[model samples]
Target: MPLNTRILLDNRPRGEASVSNFRIETVETPPLAEGQVLVRHHYLSLDPYMRGRMNDAKSYAEPQPLGEVMIGGTVGEVVESRHPRYAPGDQVVGMGGWQQYSVVDASQPGALRKVDTTHVPLSHYLGAVGMPGVTAWYGLVKIIDPKPGQTVTVSAASGAVGSAVGALAKARGCRVVGIAGGPDKCAYVKDELGFDDCIDYRQHRDYPSLAKALKQACPHGIDGHFENVGGMVLDAVMLRTNPFARMAVCGMIAGYDGQPLPMANPALILINRLRVEGFIVSEHMEVWPEALAELAELVGSGRFRPRETVAHGIESAPEAFLGLLKGRNFGKQLVKLV
Candidate 1:
């Protein structure tokens, strides 16, 4: 029997998440039943949303259960298969969680998917051409619909979702501005990702300071925004928003640690007539095909290569995830389980 090592949610966080909240265990990988395939994970995606799921609170999705495999997206290859549709050695993507291997029921519609890694690399399936890319597409195209000559901005701009948002907006003829933590990330956003300008939010601590920086960067004012970080970032963006600006509230990572993140000015939404909408991308599964096709083509063409910060082995997932929450990661954070 194959030994499958996985991390489980051991306890709920009080305020901020800690590595102690998780437990790692190794168990015998069960034999695949009919219509099941065994996936050996190569790369495991670590995202900010997982932090929110750690708390036992009312949320859009159920709180991650105690003593269960940590929920995560993984790209891997089938090592054993009982399903006729899935053959051994087939590259696949699925919610294989924080584990070295998973026995997935391929019978489910979206349970296991074979992917083409020729134009796009296998790892890209977990980042650029996968959920994050689709997330960017939904936010940019469906929610914060930008027009030519308009200015579109994104927070956490160098990340998987934010970088794609900037790229797509730039292709739409919109001035793309990004807000990131450090100078290196800001530079990558402007130079590499083709963003018009990128503001280093770390340099500007207070609201006025950041807003001043934003105003300087966005000369025409922000017409649309893809918000990943809330609190100060959102507040600063709101102050400089143009009339009837649209905001897609993808994530409020600032408030993920069981804290109240009140908006500095709720009145601005009314005054500016901003169409601010919070969304969970999974809810709109209907758009995935359209979104993925466009994203994959962009990645395949080499227009944008989403930067990644990878940690080796499953043991590193906790520390890497902690680093991500502290804004230490440059882009997409992942664990190379293989």
Candidate 2:
């Protein structure tokens, strides 16, 4: 029998989860069923979407039950395999929650991709070549469907998903502007990602002024908006969209953690004749292969660059998750457990 150390949800968080909301404990590991595999966690992905899971409120995914191990996607090495398809020493990406070790049925979604790290780092699977990469590609290329010379703006521009969206839009010959919260991220979006312009939302004093700034940068008005933070930023962008513009609402990190929800600016939506759609990357799983292939080629050829913020050790998982919610992480945030 093995002892697995895992993080459990002690109490549901109201706003801004603290380490106290989680309790870490060592417990007896369960026996692997005939189709299961025992995995030792290598890296865990800490993303903004996990914050939505922490609350008991309605969401696209089920809430984390009290006393259950906190859920997350992990890349791991198979230590023992009872399943015929997987074998010992196979490196896999799967949902293993926050733990040092886990037993999975091998039937779950995200069951690893056989990877060769010599071509690209295995960590790329968690960033530019993984879920985030797929979301940006599908949303921008297929959903928004930007035409050449069209103006596209994406918020949260320096984060993993946002940066990828901006880069792909640029590759498609669109005029791209990115909105990030701080000067550092603003500079990175413009100087690194080749965005035509980057707005520092934190520097703006008011919503109207921020709207004016975005309008100034996008003299032609926006043909598309890739929304990540959905409170005032969404409202502001809604006012700036030209007729027939498309909005892909990927996330609402601004109101995550029980922050007071803002009323939607319906007037702008109605008057501008904008088409807005909300999406979950999981829903588009069938389209992943096409997205991944394009992204991999871009990344392998140095046409795409993904920034990662890694925190060492599983013990720092809570802090890493909190940092993601607070916009402290510059890109895809990960916890290295091995």
Candidate 3:
């Protein structure tokens, strides 16, 4: 059995999350039972949603229990398989957690799906063609359905989900704008990701300044929004929305550390006739096939390129994840387990 190195939640965050919250350990991979497969993970995904799960407070999902392997998405090859459907050497993606190896019960629905690395890189199964891509699809297509010539904007625009949302919306003929942390991120969002305009949120400390920038960038007014960061970003977006605008509230990274994030202006929703909806992509299993197909086409055809920021090993996950929370990571944050 492979010796698995894993990170566990050592303690919940008091205010801001730090590397101290995690603990690392090594253990032997348990014997795979019938219908199980052993996966040696090549990469593990670090996402903002995981931060919310670290808390013991009531949330859409269960809290991360102390002393358990930290939850995360992973893509790897099946080194050993006892299941009829899965085979050794089959590349698969699953919630393999923050570990170098995982034992998956392959019989469970959506537990492990084989992926081809011929066109799309195996790591892409954890990014552009996987959960983040699906998330961007659901938010834009299902919630903030924008029409051609309409202006749409996304926060954390250079990120995994936001970049996908921008690409998907641009393909639909909508003018896309993005909000990012710094000059370099904003540049990537505009130059590389092809957003019409990218605002550097750090340049504007308050909502008023950010709102003015949005007005200049989105002259047509924001018809739809995909919100990843709340607080001032959301406030600015709300102030610039056109009538009957739509918003897909995917995450509120600004308040992930149990901080109270109140809307600055609640009246804007009714006044602007906005439809703001918050969603968890996992709940809408029905849309995965359709979403993944389109996203796969976008990625496989080389139309959309999702960037990644990788940390070298399991021990690097905590610091990498902390940087992600602080908006220090440039793109999709990943831990290279192999």
Give the Cα lDDT of each candidate. 0.92, 0.86, 0.94
Ranking by lDDT: 3, 1, 2
Clashing pairs in 1: none
Backbone clashes, candidate 2: 0
Deviation (Å) of 138 in candidate 3: 0.2
lDDT of 3 by residue, 151-232 (tens): 9999999999999999999999999999999999999988888889999999998999999999999998999999999999
Error of 2 at 233 (Å): 1.3
Ordered by TM-score, highest first, the candidates read 1, 3, 2
> With candidate 2 superimposed using the best TM-score fit, by how many Å does residue 130's alpha carbon deviate from the native?
1.2
Q: Which segments of candidate 1 are over 4 A away from where they belong? A: none
Q: Model 2: which ten-residue window has the lowest total lDDT?
A: 109-118
lDDT of 1 by residue, 1-338 (tens): 48999999999988889999999999999987899999999999999999988988788989999999999999999999999999989999999999999999999999988999889988888888889988999999999889999999999999989999987898889999999999999999988899989999999878889999999999889999999999999999999999999999999889888778988999999999999999999999999999889888888898887899999999999999999999999888999987
Error of 3 at 224 (Å): 0.2
Per-model TM against the reference: 0.99, 0.95, 0.99
Model 3 stretches astray by more than 4 angstroms = none
Best model number under lDDT:
3
Clashes of 1: 0
lDDT of 2: 0.86
